[model samples]
Target: MSNRGGVVKTLFKRDFVYTFYSWGFYVVLFAAFMISSFILKNFLDGIREEDILVSAYPLNYPLFISVIVISIYLVMLSGVSISREREHGTLEVLFYGPVTAGNFLISKYFKDLCLGIIALAFCAVYFYLVSLTTNLGFTAGLVRALVMGVFMISCVVCFGLFISSLTGRTRSSVLVLLAILGGFLALQFVHAALIGMEREALSTPMLYLRETVSHLFRGINWVSPFAFLNRGLDAVVLDSPLLFGLNIFYAVVYSVIFLILSIISMSLKGVKA
Candidate 1:
């Protein structure tokens, strides 16, 4: 147990420190904040009254956009890093030490999770400045959304790692990640659109299509990180304790299941295979 503990500590420190100092993380942070600033600027511009009920408001939309943007980058980063490391013989070298797939994966998961939290901290600071400038005081809703953001990030990175574990090469990982995420987004978009329409307005074929997509969406609730994101945001927005707690529980279960699958996938494939 002590040996495994040491292994996780060593690997976590090594990878975390390296990635922390890398320019990529900082670059992503700048990009996310820039986009957030652009969004809030337009939003404030539209409502140009000083006393227009701007104070003590929720910045959920900008925050939502920022989280989605950062998540896309982090997901790709996780997938590519794992796949590339495997290709370059990094994992093989690490495995020769006391490292096993389980601890190694846990280290990766935590390293990325910590990075996500750092990004969220930057988010807090960025939004704080926005609140100060726009006189839109950050309220409890933003805080709740940020708390929900943590679990969303976990599910996202774990999903990326799971995809990476299933593929051998970095190129394959990238391709698969894009394809799968694209499909998931398409499903959500079409599903929401169809469901928003009046039931009587739909043609016979459209009704059947909506039903099919509905079933598919339900099937993917457990498999899709975006589904988790949607549920998390809904729970926070509703301000329901029951829904919020349930979302957290579901996120944890989803993350754990994916992490275990990633470890098992790596074990089955071995380093070089």
Candidate 2:
């Protein structure tokens, strides 16, 4: 095999072996399927609309489930990847090897991405099957949902890799990953509240605030794999719609930037080790 082929094979084998042997991966898949199934069932019954609207919650059920799933996966994967290696003391060995920082990080990241793809595939397949059984056909909303799902996976993988590179301790990395994700999410809410409060009769402040907050929310939603996938699925795929132009762009750029940074950080740290 050529270099690209070799990379694929190596990454694929790693992803397949690691995820398959891990109970966590199965739990993720099972959870995703159950969530999607429940959501589909609600849609078919048409009663979901009443409950959601009556509650006045901003999130739809499927979107909410996807966000929770992606966030959990990202945090869990970050700790597992680094913590396991640290426990085995393999990270020190690998650092001393001939492997470059970029290659090493990429190999590991690719493994995470592959696992994410598999999980997302499970979500897609379940939705499809459910749709068939219920006579509810696939819609453009689902396409948006899947696209967001892929983007979210990429974001999570990159974030996880970055966290993994920061320490040899898996627990520490997982904590940091959770902190970063949670901090950003909380800040978005704070931002919306701040903006919402700036109303005045002459300023059209509330109107501007609402639109501005919505835009910011969308921006963050796209940048975060967890948030973006759900938003895209809800707005673009299922209900009141919005396109993810800048959100998509930001997400891709952020993932690339972090992946590169993680590689550089690992490379420097590896040299010291």
Candidate 3:
């Protein structure tokens, strides 16, 4: 047990350092902060003097968006990590040591999770600075959303690992992930549009199509990590303890299931192509 722990820790440290030293990490942070700041500025500017916006957590939405932007980069990083290791023969070399498929995948997951938490810390600092300048009102809700962000990022990491385990090349892994996620998002949007339209205006074929898309969107909501994040954030916004707890539970289950699948896939596929 101690040996396994040491192996995981060593790999975790190695991956963490690699991720921290990478230029992409800093770029992701900068992009997330800039986008959040831009959105906040626009939101503040839209407020008229006579109009009052009474909200418990104004920054939560921006925080959610920022976390999501960071998540995209982190997920891709996680996917690339495994495929790069395998392609470069590092994974095969590491497997000669005490490392197993589970150990490797768990270490990658933890490294990415730690990075996500660090990103959330950076997010906290960013929001604090924004509050100092703009008074955006960082409430308890934002804190809850950040906490939820950690779990959401776990889901993303595990899902990325799952995709990485299936593909031998980093580019292929990323392309596959992008295609699937894009399909889910596209379906979601189309379903939402159909729902917003007047039902009477739709032809029978269109109605059937809308129903099919709606069903597909609902299924994707359970399968996609982004959907879990959105649901968790929505629960935070609504301040529903029950929904929040449920979402958290769902995220944990999602992460665990995908992590197991990733391990199994890696084991079956072997360390090297």
TM-scores for the candidates: 0.93, 0.74, 0.96
| Candidate 3: tens digits of C-alpha lDDT, residues 1-273 | 698898999999988998899898999999999998888877787665536675668798789889999899988988777888899999999999889998888899999999999999999999988888877677888889999999999999998999999988888888998998898888888988999999999999999999998888888889999999989999998999999999989999999999999999999888885
Q: Which ten residues in a row have the lowest lDDT in candidate 1?
A: 49-58
Better of 1 and 3 by lDDT: 3
Residue 116 lDDT (model 2): 67
Instruction: List where candidate 2 sits over 4 angstroms from the true fold.
Output: 1-12, 42-64, 198-227, 230-249, 271-273
Best-matching candidate per TM-score: 3
lDDT-wise, the better of 1 and 2 is 1
Instruction: Flag clash pairs in model 3.
Output: none
CA deviation > 4 Å runs, candidate 1: 49-56, 196-198, 201-203
Looking at model 3, residue 185 earns an lDDT score of: 81
The total number of steric clashes, by the backbone 3 Å criterion, in model 1 comes to 0
Worst 10 residues of 2 by lDDT: 51-60
* TM-score: model 1 vs. ground truth: 0.93
Q: Would you list the C-alpha lDDT of every candidate in the order shown? A: 0.87, 0.64, 0.90
